[model samples]
Target: MNTVLTLMLVAPLLSAALAFAVRRHDQLRDALTLAGLGTAAGASGVMFATVAADGPFVLRVGGWHPELGIVLVADRFAALVLPVALAIIFVVELFAIGQRKTAWGSNPELSGPMMGVLTAGVSLAMLTGDLFTLFVAFELILVSSYVLLTHQGQAAQLRAGMTYVVMNLLASTLFLFGLAYVYAATGTVNLALLTERIPELPDGVRLGIGAWFFVVFGTKAAVFPLFSWLPDSYPTAPTTITAVFAGLLTKIGIYAMIRFHTLMGMDQLGNTMLIIAGVTMIVGALGALAQSHVKRILSFHIISQIGYMLMGLGLFTAAGTAGAILFLVHHMPVKTVLFLVGGLIENDQGTGRLDRTGGLARRRPLIAALFAVPALSLAGLPPFSGFVAKFAVISAGIEARATPWVVLALVAGALTLLSMTKIWLGVFWGADPDRVSVRRPPGNRPMMLAATGIAVAGTLTISALAGPLFDLSVDAAEDLRDPEIYRTAVLR
Candidate 1:
């Protein structure tokens, strides 16, 4: 188990180091990235199966016991999501390979190293245990993301990256402040221990600490009012980087929120999630509708979809929690592929705006098809992974008699369809007389093939494996709901 954990963390860092050393050799950098991501994905798959069958797996770093040192634990929830993260990295790296020259051409100094660091940061975030270590992982992700976001070295990228850095730095400060409070109150930073100990704190102190923690995590997760930074910052990064961030970074924040809610028990903060989830759905959808830029529109929808997950968390039932977990697994890969495809569109058309692009169906039928599958799936069409995941959450909502939230979710889904249709109609369908026509490059097919294959394969995987996957999600939710298993595994 320790070996697995070490491999997961070290592979990407080693790849990053190699990439830095071989920055001038584009082929070498690309090959190293592919190998690193492939290894991570393979390890994640094996670990997922291992945890699914044998229950939670724990590894204490440097052979230090869990209480005094860092512990890495994989339960059903972590196992399920970790593989999805790895898959996203794999797909995004493939897309990056296609766009490497364009991406690196923009900023030769930062692209390769930043990407490697970003990959390692995401893996570290997924694997860390205690709250303090989680904080360190979170900063690693933020700093790397800031660098990646500004990779272009353009004025807009710099400004957006700076805003992103400041907002997250402030969020990190709040998170640390909250952790200090929790540690002062409970005398421990171990998350599993905090789970058992948090309930014993005085109601007022618990509520205060919980609210502070929620604010910090909520900002990271882009919940409603705190989500302003996301739409602004995400679109300014290079498309492949944006795709990776869209798929993984925000999900990590949501992962933390769910973990904390389950471990600490949501009694004090459940209603807060309830209200925020509703607002996040409505507001996020409205934001998407208001955007005409493809990436910006997708960025807004990320927030809206996040609401679905929060709704599940707010329900506080086994079924609802399971739905949220399943949704997380489904959303990560699908969204990454969509964003990569969006990048392909931008690369070909020289823009991501719907108004300026048209006739893609006739000119680039493959890219058009790639765009359609995920777009429709994202709209929750039946027989697709999105539909299954959304159905689970909506059904859970109805079962819990949360009619208002169900209604909001339904409206949000409709708005999502509307927004997706707008993209299809403006970019893929109909003729545009205003835009200059461009010839398709021969190499475009392979890029489109890779992107489409990932999107389609992920959709099929979720649809075909829905039963067992749902079971895994439920098992994860159960582990999360009762932290004794995780605590015992990690602490012993």
Candidate 2:
């Protein structure tokens, strides 16, 4: 178990270093990067299975106690989410390999190494057993992402990267301060220990801490008013970078919110979270409806979908948390695949502006087919994983009698479907863009398509396995709702 956890964190960093070392050799760099990601993804799968069968596993770095040193835990929640998250990164890296040969790919010189850094950060963020360590993991991710976004040095990318970096910097500052506040109030930053010490604080102090981290994580999650940076920033990056950001980055923020709030028993703030969730839903959907560009529309939809996950967390029930977890799992690959298809559309027709694209359903039926499944899933249509996830969350809200929030969620779903329909009609059913004939370079289209196909297949697999996944989520949520389960496992 310890070896597996170590590989999940170390393999990526090692691969990243090696890839950077041999950056001049294209094939070798790509191979090393993929191998590292593959290793982490495989380790996460093993950890997930092992934890499910045995229970949570903890790794104490340098053989030190939790209070004084770093700790990593593969609890049910981490175990369940890690595999999906790592798998998405691995698939994106594969797509990146194929994409780098195309006009829309990220800079081949730096993208491979940077992606490795991002993968390591993600693994660390998910597994860290303490608040301070989580913050460190966030920096690792933010730094890699900053470089990824701006490495091309295009004017628009630089402008958007500034917004992305500044907002995240402010949030990171607040996060550090929150860590201090937590330590001052509780005398330690270890999550398991905080679980014991936090509830003992006064109600005002306790909720203050909860609300503080809420803003910190919520900014990262791009919820509500804090989300303007996401739609503006995401669409400016290369397609592969945007896909990873859309799929994993904001979701990490909500992941933290779920872990922190649930384990610390922040149920009192449920109403506040619910209100924010509703506003985020409507605002994001409206933003999507207003977009003319495919990437921007999809970017806005990321915010809209976040509202559902927040709604689930706000319900603060085992069912709701499970719903949120299931939603996170479903959203990652589905969102990534959608963005990859957007990339394909742009690469094929020269633009992602919906006004400039049409008739892809006839001209490139495969890309159209690839887009449809995830699009329907994103719209929460029946028999898809998104529908199952949305049902779980909305039903939890209904059971909790959170009537207004439930209504907002339903309205948001309708708007989401409408926005998706806009994409289909504008990009797939109308006249194709008019331009001079330019032959596409016989680049790595097959590899890109194959990578995308794998992701699309993964989303379908999620839909097929929804029943068992939800049951697993329920167990994870049970652990989350009862802090003692985590507290005991880590502190024992």
Candidate 3:
């Protein structure tokens, strides 16, 4: 298990190094990127199998135990997210392979290396065990994402990437500062240790540190006030890059928030999360409604959807936490597919502006079908994964008797439906022949097929595996609610 986890982290970095060294060989570069991501995905599967059969697994570096050294911890929550992350990266990589000719053809060298590094960073972020290590992984992801966002070197891309860099660097600094405060007070950076010790700190210190951590992570997760950077930056990146970032990066921040809240003890800051969660939902949805571009609309909804995950965290019950976990797992893939399909639509039609596009459903029926599944699923339609995930969170809210939060969540769902349907009607279902066009050559069939396949598979995974996956999420929530299992495995 430890070997597999180590391989997962190293495979991409090693491939990245190889990619940089062999930059001129297009075939080799593409092969290395695919192979590296494939290996990481395989390693994720192995880690998942090991955890399913053997419970939790922890790997300590330098022969130092958890409290004394860096660790990589994998329990049910981490395990479940690992595969979803891998799947998103894998599909995006495949799409990149086909779209490279039209999309990244101008600067293959920059796009290739940056993407390898980005995939590696996501793998590391999901597996690192402590706050400091998580910070380092996040910075790695940020740097890689910056390069990807600005790969086109367009004026808009540069401006958006710069904003993204500035925002993330600030978040990284606050994260490091908060981690220093946490370590200075507790004398260790290990999450397992922090879980046991945070409760003993004075309320003033605890709340202060918790608040710093929340602001830092909230910024990264694009919550409420801190989310302005997201809409500006995300929609300008190359579609593939935008899709990957949309799917994984913010969720990594959300994952860290969940881990820290559980470890630091949620009781100390439940009310804070409760208030933030409500505001995030309302504000995010309203922002989504204001967007006219397809990517921008989806980007705004990302912030709103995050509120549901935060609501689960705020409730802090075992069930609420479980719902949050399930939502995170479900949301990442659904959002990724939506964004990728959006990219494909924009690529084929040459624009994502709602006013400029229409009648895609009649022109490209398959693409329309692919887009509808995740879009509707994201809007929380039943028999799809989104519905199941939202049901879990809303049910948990009800069970916890969080009436206001539940109402906010329900309203957010309705607004989400409105936002997605806005896209569907304006971009897909209309009949304005003058507003529709197709630029894809016959050779581009593979690209469309690849993107469509992924969207279909994502919808199927959620619908068919809902029962087992939700059960896994439940177990993960239990492990998180009681950190003894994690602590013992890591520290022993």
Best-fitting candidate, scored by lDDT: 2
The sequence of per-residue lDDT tens digits that candidate 1 reaches over residues 142-255 is: 888887887667998888888898889999999899888988999998888887788888899888877887788888889989999999999888777888889988888889
Backbone-clash count (model 2): 0
RMSD, one per candidate, in order: 1.8, 0.9, 1.6
Candidate 2, overall lDDT? Answer: 0.94
The digit string of per-residue lDDT tens for model 2 on 1-492 reads: 889999998999999999999999999999999999999999999999899999999999998999999999999999999899999999888888887877788887799999999999999999999999999999999999999999999999999999999999999999999998998999999999998899999999999999999999999999998998999999999999999999999999999999999999999999999999999999999999999999999999999999999999999888889999999999999999999999888888888888778899998899999999999999999888899999999999998899999999999999999999999999999886787233366258888899999999999999999999999999989988888889888888
RMSD of 2: 0.9
List the candidate 3 regions with Cα displacement exceeding 4 Å. 103-106, 433-443
lDDT of 3 by residue, 1-492 (tens): 767988888888888889878988988987988888888889999889889999898888787877777888888788988888887787787777677666422266677777778777887777778878888889888998888888678999888888899999999988888988998999988888888888889889888988899999899999888998999999988777888889888898899888888767756688789889899988989889988889999999899989999998988898888889899988988888888888777876778988888888987888898888888888898889889999999999899888998999889889999999899888888776474455544235576567658656976787789999889988988888888877887777
Lowest-sum lDDT 10-residue window in model 3: 435-444
Best by TM-score: 2
Please, what is the whole-model Cα lDDT of each candidate in the order they appear?
0.82, 0.94, 0.84
